[model samples]
Target: MKAERRTQWLRGVLDLCILGVLYDGEYYGYAISQRLEQAGLGHIKGGTLYPLLARLEEMSLVTSRWTVRQQGPGRKYYVLTEQGRRVFEEQASDWTMFAEHVATLIYRRGE
Candidate 1:
């Protein structure tokens, strides 16, 4: 179905989307998910978001720290590293070019 294909496409670029969100500043897991949803990414679950965060951390693209809140347990906040910024910049450029090409192909006029 179209929805399923859309989900697959979204997954393919989820990392870039996450990096874009983090580019602004640090965010906790829940906050990241919410921001992505607000940005039209739809409802991304904790299961999916957490593992990606872990992978980004493992790749040294992001760093995290636990901040204790007054009313509840601590939350782990993630921030983009210098390397992440570079990666994001490169990836964003690549994505823009790729998207333009795809759009052109999709909208091409018949000769």
Candidate 2:
């Protein structure tokens, strides 16, 4: 599996993934990207990530707050809204089923 192939697939589910991350708690932009990579999503750049965050905000799926820090510049942290939680739950269930079906086809398992 090449990186480009994965990137194409990722676009379809990035929003759900971001919501899934926020489900645990709040995270700033950079940390969110780190968590995504840690979860094997790969490195998502700001150019790609920030706009998605903005779109999520616009969609009312997530809300953000800026926390001031004495040590350095403040960061905007994002958290999932109540509606976002519901949406995530629904999408996650759908994705799980869809992924299983896709895997079955790809692997020719249970045929």
Candidate 3:
């Protein structure tokens, strides 16, 4: 039940986090998942992450390209578009304010 609730909460801002990961540079799916986990976002499943990536691509928020290395299978790397950068900056501010409000409500010292 706790995990389910956390998953629901994560869904609300996972896109922003994904964009945050790409803000550094291009990364393939597994690397993106690793970055998210490194940031304490837990492991984002491909079932959730890939479709969201496709949606972001559809919305022009991100772009992807497939790259094949000599030693490994091809990987579709994703990068944040210029529009994605703008959206990330704006929504990140909004999320910050929203989180602050939630924190205030939840952490009030007195009733």
C-alpha RMSD of candidate 1: 1.3
Against the correct fold, how does model 2 do in TM-score? 0.95
Worst 10 residues of 3 by lDDT: 1-10
- Candidate 1 lDDT at 59 equals 99
Judged by lDDT against the true structure, how good is candidate 3?
A: 0.95
Candidate 3 lDDT, 1-111, residue by residue in tens: 488887998989999999999999999999999999998878899999999999999999999999988997999999999999999999999999999999999999787
Clashing residue pairs in candidate 1 are none
lDDT of 2 by residue, 1-111 (tens): 798899999999998999999999999999999999999999999999999999999999999999999999999999999999999999999999999999888999566
**Candidate 3 deviant stretches above 4 angstroms:** none
Q: Return the lDDT, model 2, position 39.
A: 98
Clash pairs, model 2 backbone = none
How much does candidate 3 score in TM-score? 0.95
**Candidate 2: misplaced stretches above 4 Å?**
109-111
Candidates in order: C-alpha RMSD to true structure: 1.3, 1.4, 1.2
Write model 1 residue lDDT over 33-107, tens digit each, in one string.
999999887889888999999999999999999998999899999999999999999999999999999999988
| lDDT, each prediction | 0.94, 0.96, 0.95
